[model samples]
Target: MSVYQGRFEGRCAIVTGGASGLGKAAAARIVAEGGKVVLWDLNADALAAAKAETGATDVVALDVSDQAAVAAAAKASEAALGKVDILICSAGITGATAPVHEYPLDSWKRVVDINLNGLFYCCREVVPLLLANGYGRIVNVASVAGKEGNPNASAYSATKAGVIGLTKSLGKELAEKGVIANALTPATFESPILAQLPKSQVDYMRSKIPMGRLGEISESAAMVCFMASEECSFTTASTFDTSGGRTTF
Candidate 1:
């Protein structure tokens, strides 16, 4: 049973990275609250699992970094859902943990491709569809590291920072177009993505949080739902925080 039943009675959403982690959490909430959702991820098996777990209406397996794929996904989602009301971009990577001098150029490019360019592609393809409907909400998942500049993770930090900038620019452009956009900046959170990093890297991130804890996946999902809600009106081009007191701004 959902506490906020029917908040999304007729809404439809596209949740990128919906196979797991934050994206799956958000998708589950949307479904529980009476919304239709389409899950998109890079893994077909994982996407299938998520679809069954969350009761999402559909799933699309594609890399967000692929522009043409994203374009086709937008069309497919529009066709399947009738109209897209929300876009939650939570698909990203941590890249390799290394000092700037030691960071691999290929790894940096890969991070930028998925974290920044991928988001750009999603927003680019979806915004026009939203504009046609005259209503939409977009929540791009960023990171506190983007603002604080975490040590030895320059690639992840720089690309996440780019996500913030991208959201801000899109929000402003859509201000008068009945669409809203924002970035969610989270600190060290309990996510599968964290597993990609060394334990020491994860520990360093947790140490920076005043609460000395990783944020629960549900906590971040709550914020994503709120930002994706029509109730979140009057706030665009802003960043919402789930940094466990690590970030006050």
Candidate 2:
């Protein structure tokens, strides 16, 4: 990938799930463009690896599902970075795949807690910081499954749908402010997260994509960088598609 020397210069970004997958890709992109980034994830080992790989400005190991932890991290971020200009909520999990009737209650709640509530915590804690600075960009990672539900993955689908909805509402609320909110609905991608889904389900998702292949992390990161940049001005509460033709709307 070519370097983007100054697109994000003078900016500080916070990327949840920065230890791996799409979040790591986004963090790497921002750092490549001369931006400072704080990596937040539950895995300390992966966080260390990402810091080594991406040269992120800082790393914090915490579960975003905990509102108190999120608040603390937000405070720490302000102390270290002085201000936050970008937020990428990429931390999530693919909960167990089963029909709604057969889905385990525990699994269902776990998915909602981590995927939906966790994102809310991050946004709630960070948006105020952004408002204080009078400038910010928020990129929430939804999924094509959110737009068009996939059979047998009710919990995962529902939480992702909620993410898209939340982005829209938050964007509208912050419309007049410099901070903007947007969502990205990507199809299946080549990432460790893919291992969580059933083989049959993974194959089924890929087959539905016109491209006939999983998306590359670079593709998602590229679009996210643009959305997290100043060029994304005037486009808030919008859902951007990176579904390889799998998403019609």
| Candidate 1, poorest ten consecutive residues by summed lDDT | 1-10
- lDDT tens readout by residue for model 2, 1-249: 666789999999999999999999999989999999999999999999999899898899999989999999988877777789999999999999899899999999998998999999999999999999899999999999999998989999999999999999999999898999999999999998988988999998999999999999999989999999999999999899999999989
Over 4 Å off, model 2: none
TM-score of every candidate: 0.98, 0.98
lDDT of each: 0.94, 0.93
Q: Residue 5 error for model 1, in Å?
A: 0.5
After superposing candidate 1, which stretches have Cα over 4 Å from the reference?
Answer: none
lDDT score for residue 206 of model 1: 90
lDDT (C-alpha) at residue 241 in model 2? 90
Q: In model 2, which range of ten residues has the least summed lDDT?
A: 74-83
